[model samples]
Target chain A: MGVVVTSPQFKDNARQAMADAPLQRALGHVRKNFIERRAAAAAGLPEFEALRDSARDIKNHTLAHLDLYLEEWERKVLAAGGHVHWARNAAEANRAIVDICKARGAKTVTKGKSMISEEIGLNDALAAAGVAAIETDLGEYIIQLRGEHPSHIIAPAVHLNKDQVESDFRRVHTHLPKERDLAEPTALLAEARAVLRQKFIEADVGITGANFLVAETGSSVIVTNEGNGDLTQTLPKVHVVIASIEKITPTMEDVAQLLRVLARSATGQEMSVYTTFSTGPRRPGDPDGPQEYHVVVLDNGRSSMLGGDFEDMLRCIRCGACMNHCPVYHAVGGHAYGWVYPGPMGSVLTPTLIGVDKAGHLPNASTFCGRCESVCPVRIPLPKMMRHWREREFERNLSPAALRSGLKLWAFFARRPALYRLATRLSTKALHLMGRTKGRFAKMPLASGWTDHRDLAAPQADTFQALWKQRRETR
Target chain B: MTARDDILANIRRARGVAGGEAPRRAAVEERLARAPTGIIPARARGDAAHRLALFRARVEAASASFATVADAAAAPDEIARYLRDANLPATLRMGADPRLAALPWAGTAIEIARGASDGHDLNAVSFAFAGIAETGTLALVSGPDNPTTLNFLPDNHIVLIEAADVVADMETVWARLRERFGKGALPRVLNLVTGPSRSADIEQTLLLGAHGPRRLHVVLVGAGEIGRQD
Candidate 1:
């Protein structure tokens, strides 16, 4: 929210990331680590597959009867002395949060990492209204200082290196002595800690995103390694939790089952360091906690997903497991998606949330690689969902006219086996003729983007369908 | 438009596909009634030693320090020495547990505070209620003696642990907690401290302390019946 990088579209962002040698190298290194660690963690448990299936079924059941669960959640929260405000969309959610801040006369707001806040762009609205919003999460704070959106959901500043952070710190912390060495990790942390301590004490309002909402107890769960979340929620007088309505589970047992998969899939840990749950405002005899607890349940296009084809997408716990395993996400990284959410799940959800006009390029970013779906702890059929989005985009006439016509022509022939076989044979002959050397096409009429990065291998003289026909005739 | 109208209008717009009856609610009561009361995995009792070793390796990997003591009485002195060696002051806040409070430390120069106060003055020491061997986690329950502030506000945290209380897995630890406190019970704060506060936010560089304790020291007490024999 500090500064929007509006110059780059999705294509432009992808090109830039691909061209940057350092970023590509870093992506390669980090992506391998995540994939390898997750596989090792999954292999350790025999019931991991069964657990995924069960988790998926539970999420599906809850989402199918979301209205009933939501009502039950609202009643439980209110009974626990907490207030639940329902927001229809981003605008309503943002306006409601700002209004709450205004009523409390809040000047400074501290926040724990909540993707819902990012989805609503709440900080931008708060800053415009003269309220200083501070990101308490270390990763979030770095990105906030850099004036950029989070590139990765879990590790926001995973793309940055030490020197970049050193420069950012020097620019922000002018009070520090110029001679003070910022080369080491210790020094950088000390500087950030000193700065955030003051913000924690001064902030009047605290906001956080819930990892899970236990409907039975009306408690919002936050899992983090650093204790910044605890400080963010406890230090302020008024606490606001912005979460999607689908985050609620029936009971703590359901929460336990989800947590079993959540941490193991995320960072290969048995459990995250801190899994703190808060029911409501500070009770009597409590020494320190928020006085006013407000939970803003933002539907924001998710409720629409409940009974629709994309309902399974709601089961995502935002663990970043699917993104970590995605081939395209590894190649292009998160910024290429050009939205709040990115990666495989982002491809399906973004188009649905923002409409195809804004995010039509997302679904095409995938290779239909089943890696993401295979690794998903909740078993979201990501590739199929992406295909659905592509289908919707074409139906809405959102795609370019030429591309739509090309798809139509291909579909026409694809339906007729004889015409499709004939077309394939002719194209194979033409490709062989064009390739005089070992099969590699430098440029193609329709696929310039593919050839621009690397040469595409030319097809053989005989198509697979033609070979099948010849074999049958000979037999 | 009124507030209710505005809310309803937003809901209508956000709703995806309508016209279908709501799905039938699944019967959770029947499932819970038939579900197993416990699912604790069986392991050899000798495996506790191996689990403790693995837990230590993980804690070290996370960049925390651990030292095994012969007895709880030796822990206070050893901790005082560690603080002194680290250039930290000897002032400490002790938990309310009588076993921890009774440790004789006449030879040690450290001054023990009776209860939790502002941790800004110096180091705070407390006895962990239980140690989880699975994730190298220490459970801290707040009571009259164990003020939650000692867990956070301090720069350095030193925890005393009994070797016998170390459980081999998280499920085992949870079972113990359930037995101690019934289903409806929850403390104001149930802290599961795993290593010291760490962050990789700044350019993906690992920083030991972002906001919480800069250093975490664990004194594993192997005394009396709790001591693990070599």
Candidate 2:
């Protein structure tokens, strides 16, 4: 893979991320912006919850019959004179894309924001094949200039401040006026738009990601607010869509259901500015648009996830709502997760794609506040999936020795209720008496990791079991 | 084995079924043949008048501008007026749509250009196939009639939507599309544009006119009622 897997050092990565001042400032935006906007959008529509359910069911049904849907989609794509390339993994997916681009002798290709492309490391693959891919999404463009992956799926440059963007623009875009006023976000946006517009017109190939692939009509749908996706796909001679197998929907009706919840959950817009459904190459007598249409249908370990514990994860639409609502994500930002995806969804999804041993910390990073599942448009039961991963990690002896011993020690007493109650009662009384003066512990043995960040609240004189028995008997 | 076969085989094996399951195939074919509707929002269940108002409200809320004309003939004047009021150029780009061509642009001083845009035009107008009221979205099909480029490559994109084409929900738009394009088929590009181009990529602050049109103005003709009746 072109991208480095930093998931193994997730703890160290998170520690470094927490210490970065600019990153902390940038992460403040994720907390301040996404949560309120999503809540407002959901509150505005009465059927928002029902729409989420419908979206989930549509994805579930499509996945259950995924083989049929994929075959049907491929047949329709062929019927429409479009090419379908099946990729079993990331390398194959990138191979198909590079071959398509190289066959046309493309020097430069403009790209829309697509997580599938990131997952497959397509840009790195293209570079190796002597092709340059220009990211057209504004957020993607900024991070691309910095030689970084997207911090968030939808908001790629959410971890960047305007000042940082200003410097990046000044540093990279030297041909522009050196004294250009780019202190404001608007000026930076104008510059990027001007620069990318020429690339859009000049590029030989255009690659995009699909939000939904319709099997009935053999169309690929892309939803974008900046209209960059349209420009990327429409301007080039060849339009290549990179999407996973689970993106397929049964029909346009199902697409509508998903779209209804997508923008609301992601950006709080009633609808994105542009949602384009492309069937095939430019038709006969068409004035503009691409001449060649190709879709790279990738499995990438998703097909193997079916009928498994991670099957619910396949229904995810990549809306980023889970990350937006996640407190851990808000604290560390997406980079700490060390993958294209981050937050609760990544916690479950990352382990499956890259082995559980590598991504073990992602699942354990969650606060288990259940906000992600509550806000998930498809209701993927994120915490439940994370727990499953933890179980898998422990069963394989992947967790630390201390954690395993602690768990085993607790389980030994928990199996015997009398011993467990006595142990808890004695421990709580001893700790409460010791901490009675301060009512909290700033430092403690074996728990300094937790206390270092914040003082640990002292335990009470009695366990919850004893308190519950007393209350029930008195009642 | 080929990648396609391998992937398909893996999925089938995981699901504990061969590709020849008649029931599964039938279910897939049935869903594809009959694209059924899902739970449409109650907000879209209003009358046509309410639909028109909601369409205007939602479209405006999406950061797009619109004006109502008494008839199709009045659209050209309104278009000119909007352009003049907004201080935009008098030149307009469009396709050879007969509906737009039939309008008497000779009465105005506006310069009219024809065919799809090559990214140089500042103002462009395309006729929308449908206007969905649920999210104030405009569905424009790609062909010679309304090139997809015009929908994205202009500074000011002005679309003329007939009152009769306005629908309450996206599901209805699907029905209209199927009726026109036939089942299991679609145009090269069906663009559902709600507002003008915008981006919040830098510091989560929204900026308009990013890589696409800076302004999207809708001219709804015959706006008093839903159908052709005055």
Candidate that would win on lDDT: 2
Instruction: Report how closely model 1 matches the true complex, as a DockQ value.
Output: 0.34
Residue pairs of candidate 2 with colliding backbone atoms: none
Deviating ranges (above 4 Å) for candidate 2: A471-475, B225-230
Predicted candidate 2 versus true structure: per-residue lDDT over B1-230, tens digit per residue: 99999999999998999988899999898888778898888986867788888888888888898788889898889889999999988999999899989998988879999998998998999999999988899999999988888999889999999988999988898889889998889899999999899999998998999998999998899876333211
Q: In model 1, what lDDT does residue B214 have?
A: 80
In order, what are the TM-scores of chain A for the candidates? Answer: 0.93, 0.98
* Candidate 2 structure lDDT: 0.92
Q: After superposition, how far is residue A55 of candidate 2 from its true place, in Å?
A: 1.0
As a whole number from 0 to 100, the lDDT of residue A2 in candidate 1 is 27
Instruction: Name the regions of candidate 1 deviating beyond 4 angstroms.
Output: A1-8, A433-458, A472-475, B1-62, B67-74, B94-107, B114-122, B162-165, B168-182, B220-230
Residue pairs in steric clash, candidate 1? A304-B16
